[model samples]
Target: MTAAPSLDSKYYEAARPRSLGERLTGAARQRIHADFLRLCRPGPETTILDVGVSDVINDAANGLERHYPYPHRITAVGLGAAEAFRAAFPSVAYRQVAADCRLPFADGSFGIATSNAVLEHVGSPENQRLLLAEMARVARTVFVTVPHRFFPVEHHTAIPLLHYTDAGFRWACRRLGKEEWAQQQNLILMSRRRLAALVPPGRTARLGRTGLPLGPFSSNLFLLLTP
Candidate 1:
């Protein structure tokens, strides 16, 4: 599978200042976090679990802490082998964990568990379930976000490929001399109905679901679930 280009530089440059502005303007780290604050009703005593934390210098925890109620503990775990995350949030706790599937945490260990765009990169449906299960087991609430299936894969890289059916999309790619792009390597696309099945029915409840602008009409769906 061809690795997508670093979303760090381009995304960071544009999204960073905007994110900081959100913090200043009280946007909280995207819609999910805004929903989290509403649903979880986080206080200074709350603790958060952030899965699949990246190797970025300014991690989400700090950003959330800045916006949302602070003095709360945030534990971030990810697969990357970079100390940048550690150095970035020296005051907060940080750990390195595999993003493939299993999460090493006890049941109901946190008030909230969050994963932003992590499930798509999990590589397989089974692994995605494992990650979701772990997210549910560790926290009473789980929040996740991913690119909508309707969104073209190349659109993620700012290259708009033709809008094709799931099968037709791949077939058309092959005809267009881009067959290799069709391989189902990572970034599994899932529907909202499918995602709702991941957590326990009785324990889970959708806090919010909305499409945020990725470009203009295109956007990513963000969900906040209580499990």
Candidate 2:
């Protein structure tokens, strides 16, 4: 089995605010924050578990803690300690755990659980399912985000059109001078239908698009699941 790509890969780095993708992601973040507020209705006492938190130095690449109304209530988990994150958000709790193992928290331990843009890099469909199941198991409400497969521009490689139609997109990426990114093995583009199917049958869930100028064909898919 292919190992998951490292979180340090350039593919996961934050884009500059001036870049088109980052601008769109910033807009999407606002909508995501609003939806989370409405769906989870987090309060001062609410406990949030943010799984697979990005360790990137860039604030934009980090997790939902930045947007949460109560950052102190969030427990951010990552595969390794993120010194930069710790320095930036001194009040937020951070935990490090093995990437391949189950989440360290007990079932329904948090009022909200979230992960952003981390699912595609988990390496396989089975692992993706496990990640989602764990999120659902540990929180009464779950919010997750992933890049939409059919988006015209593939966010990671910044290549247009080929990601959806070509199985050889990786090769195409290398041919287009994105050799370094193409070498990283773990990105698996996902569609709304596939994401919906991944939810365990009993969970009540809704799926929608955010990051406009593309509307339903937006670059990201936002999923909310509740028990």
Candidate 3:
């Protein structure tokens, strides 16, 4: 019999890792960065609009900002103050934007629109689709990643098994006194089917998994949409 991959709880927060989780996240993000470059194949002149970059100043926070060779070609947007993110990536332009609103960019302004592990935090399913639609509107190609819903560990709250179900996950979160996580405003896990359904009717989208690929149990899922 084959051995199943071990996903230790200490490093389960792949979305936004902390402490011991950071080591796992750093490595996983490196892999994600490499895959992004390989699959998206952006050129030196390709302007990238990165959606949902965090204000957190950790080394693992923004993989593209850290790994991309041309920071000047990257424009990042998020819901937090850009001061910290701007300080971290001085050459990359940063913009502050609401999570659910249309991106403040003209149509086809960028060659690519990219986001990592941010779709789950955008509130309802409607908001999630809106983010995708906005990304599609502003760029000819869209590359977005979200934590896999069935990836064994629940990312935000870091609880296992019980988080497989929304009602059960909320009940467990409340019992653990994590009131914020129990709220729908914080997170909504994603599966490939759910993600596929979010793409606009006429658009062409390719879905794949990367980062800690334990087959169907891979830690992350990505959507690559192109015109």
Best by TM-score: 3
Residue 36, candidate 1: alpha-carbon lDDT:
58
Kindly report which residue stretches of model 2 are placed more than 4 angstroms away from their true locations once superposed. 1-9, 177-185
Which window of 10 residues has the lowest lDDT sum in candidate 1? Answer: 1-10
**TM-score for candidate 3:** 0.89
lDDT of each: 0.57, 0.73, 0.77
Per-residue lDDT of candidate 1, residues 73-183 (tens digit): 887776655466566556557666754567778889888887665676666777777787787888887777655555444322222445334576566666776554455
- Number of backbone collisions per candidate, in order? 0, 0, 0
Ranking by lDDT: 3, 2, 1
Model 2 residue 53 CA deviation (Å) reads 1.6
Top lDDT: which candidate number?
A: 3
Instruction: Tell me the lDDT of candidate 2.
Output: 0.73
Flag clash pairs in model 1. none
Task: Please give the TM-score that candidate 1 achieves against the real structure.
Answer: 0.71
Cα RMSDs of all predictions?
5.5, 3.2, 7.0
Number of residue pairs clashing in candidate 3, backbone atoms closer than 3 angstroms, sequence gap of 3 or more or interchain: 0
